[model samples]
Target: MSSKEKLNDAFSTISDSFLTECARPLKKTVFQKRICRLLPLVAVLVSIAILLPIAVFRHKSDLIPGRWTLISHADETVRKEMLVESAHKPTVSMSMNYNKLPAEQAEAVGFSPEKDPCVELFAQWFYSQITYDYRMHFSLFQKEAVDYSFTSEAIERGFTFESALDKLDTVTSHFYNGIKYDLFYSLVSCKDLTAELENTQGQFYKSIVRCGADPAKISMIVEYTFDDIKLIMNERFLNTSPDGERFNFMFYCYDGHWYIFETEMENDFSIDVLGKDEDWLSILIVPQECYGRVVAVGRGYLLLDNGEYFMTLDELDLKVGDYVHVSFTGFQTKGRFIADDGSTEQKVTCNNLLTVKLAEPSTPSEEERSNE
Candidate 1:
């Protein structure tokens, strides 16, 4: 028999219903076919969904132009007051495309690696600061770099600023409000620089890396003058490290701009870095006396209404409610002054009480008196 006849004889033994069922076409079910056809379309839709936001964000911050890039979108509100205008007219001409460049004073004065754009940034943006009428230092802090924020990790570890951009209020608190740094020396020099770059791998590296800015900006810079060493600390300590050097500060680049962030030299109200009234007392930053009104008094100490707690000198015999002229140095001989009542508060001594008045008190008008 032929192979076709053999197949027909075999099929004839099966039921007609089986034969009929076998004659049906072998094809996918409607539900299966619909799912298969929809998968490619769903995949295309999913791809669009994933890429849409990224495309939008990239479209916004596509480029960081130069120093101090603004992070706001076109629709975002504009900043005011604290906003620093971006300008880069290099004193030592260099390419605008580079990350770092040498500055005038930093190079001419031979600062080694300190001759960076940061120094130039300082020279132009904040020349009045280091050589400031330091008396007004606190009030000037509102002026800033591109963007600013604190690092929680650095603070939690008891390390104040590990090259992170921060506010200078704590450091500024140490300054005799309204004192200028130029009082000690007419000729100021670019003392030192510590430009610490943040690691690209760091969790806190909020850099404009895409725009070619480094993950780390700049960290610390100190300005010092040896003028007051002998007078401030006496001969013995005059041979020491700071030698009554004026200010130690922190700096960093944020949002593509530079900032003279904080003074690392001292924290008068807290546990201080430079302690000892004699160290910074006579080197007064304030042109006038700091006035303190006695709210509370204790043995060898007096508490002022402004929360100033200071140990009194043997010569300063002051009483409560007396509007005494006072000054504060960031330095303290002791971290905390223990009171007879077993209490303690940070204080600058009565020597700053303007014990020997420099000028006779002048009577003020009603407006000045009321304002005071």
Candidate 2:
């Protein structure tokens, strides 16, 4: 009935209540403890589920939906040596006049300066036209007249050899390591240019103007840098001197991110444009469904329609004079094509071939042949 008696009673009651709560179900207590232990893992899984798509999208930034390969000359010294071997090979002479065509051919083709804008542009503005006669045995296609002329305006505007070198100095001044400038240079630089060459007689000299970009095909994206920089080069533009040498306006986008495309020395000493060591990489834009007919088949490459050709890795079971349709789904170059020049460091050229099929050749009837 005193204060001590009350305090003792209250302590006993509190101790009993605490023990009773601790003696509750052990299974429920263990389950709650397990959930608490897994909380960090659950949070991590939830975060990954929400961010996986964002990570994938970031990885694929600046990737265009097509395929292309990176090419670089490992050794310029080897290239120069190969050039020496190519020049002494046998060569034949051929000529073409853009201003005037043969009477019979002119009647059928009708590419007069009055009717055709291209013809008129070349004839009225351009001064000289030259032809490139191949001296090699490997013919991807029949030798067509490789000729071009430049307009006076394009010549005046195009880059000269000396001026192009000067522009190269100015452009490279802004370059530093890891700072990408392919797209920036392409946007600001002048792509077309002119160069001088000696005549065939080795007596006189001439200047070549520019052909400009082809309206049919705008430009080809060749180099895609690691920083997602794309270097676009316009379709092949060409000029020629009185001698049988070619001057090409090529965008040197790989090593030198300069604007003034340089002139390449294309002559008997030069490798055939289709042979092995051409810089520009072409995309198979139009499939056979668009327009392709096989005319001839060779070891590694096939001839389509007339001049078009595609190389394959494995030898196709195709034959010459077979009419067929070709289709390409994608582009891929796996292995390297080793040149016979005996270089230890071979070139890494891709075998990006189109998946093609062959069909039975259609035979023309006697009447059809006679009509032809």
Candidate 3:
């Protein structure tokens, strides 16, 4: 009676305890399933709250605050064709004058007397002048000039021949400040030791010379034109050629002025100098008037009363309530121009037309807002 009764009592107590624990867990499981079903709805509401602000911020229409409409050309066929032509164009090579230095001067600019001493002096001098001013330096030869001319060869290219010529002229002008005609004239008038070799018209000697200050050290470059060679020797060498490469013919800035120490030229054309990078952001500004608001610091929009006018940011330095003259391209809208005639809708030329200010910021609403 003792062993059997004790075993049965222990089994019954264990069964009751297990059933009570299972009942609590079952209830918890049901509650967790219900929460899982509602989680998606809560997540969707949270996402909506996060996206609303972004949507409102991007809602730009009619040029209103928090809304903007940018008008850009959708057809880029012309631009693409122009870009392709530009990419495939061949580069132009410029020839420098090494014979500008005579045989004696060539030895002075690190040019070996054993080698072609005549041109070595000129090459040495040219290299020194170029390396001296890295920012404004142009290689004695510009590859872009050739490249541009090559690109312009394609007749179907977007820009006209005149336009291409204009661009080339613009780029070349950046190399030197003097007028092209005057420079050419001066080169023709210069006389030097090489000029003594010229017998008559069209008989020219091509030489490069480096002549500056020191007689021992010199720079070397190549020369092809007799006039350029003579100009260098007459203006730069003081009518005398250095004896050996011991002279420093390279120009050094002394007291903010460029002074040549010595001179020489190389006979070979293998010397390489890096080309100048193009200025992409070059722009011309024109004055014009348009309606714009000083909405915030450093922010303003020039609005044209004529709906079709559009201008580039590069064309004008605009400010709030400042009257300016502007020219733009767009369609025309029929509008009443307040003139001697009271009020009559007139067909106005809008697209790509020059606009003169009829008045400054005169809208009552804009004035009230400004006061606020």
**Candidate 2 error regions (>4 Å):** 1-293, 305-307, 328-353, 361-372
What does the lDDT come to for candidate 3? 0.25
For all predictions, the C-alpha RMSD in Å is 32.1, 32.1, 33.0
**Residue 181 in model 1: lDDT:** 11
Give the top-scoring candidate (TM-score). Answer: 1
> How good is model 2 by TM-score?
0.20
Between candidates 1 and 3, which one is better according to TM-score? 1
Task: Kindly list the per-residue Cα lDDT of model 1 for residues 1-372, writing each as its tens digit.
Answer: 999999999977998888888797765332221100111111111111001111222322333332332233354522111112122210111111111223454455344332344334332323223222222333222232111222233354355542322223334333322111111111123444332223443222322343244444444433322121111110001011122333222344444554444331112111221222433433443323466566655433455656554433333455566666665442222222333443433332322222322232334658998999
Query: Model 1: how far is 372 from its true place, Å?
Result: 52
Residue 49, candidate 3: C-alpha displacement in angstroms: 32
Tell me how many residue pairs clash in candidate 3: 74
Q: Which whole-number lDDT from 0 to 100 does residue 367 have in model 2? A: 98
Candidate 2: residue pairs that collide: 159-193, 200-243, 332-352, 333-351
Candidate 2, residues 200-295: lDDT per residue as tens digits? 221111111233332122221111101111110010001111122122222211122211111222222122122233222123222334234655
What is the alpha-carbon lDDT for the whole of candidate 1?
Answer: 0.31
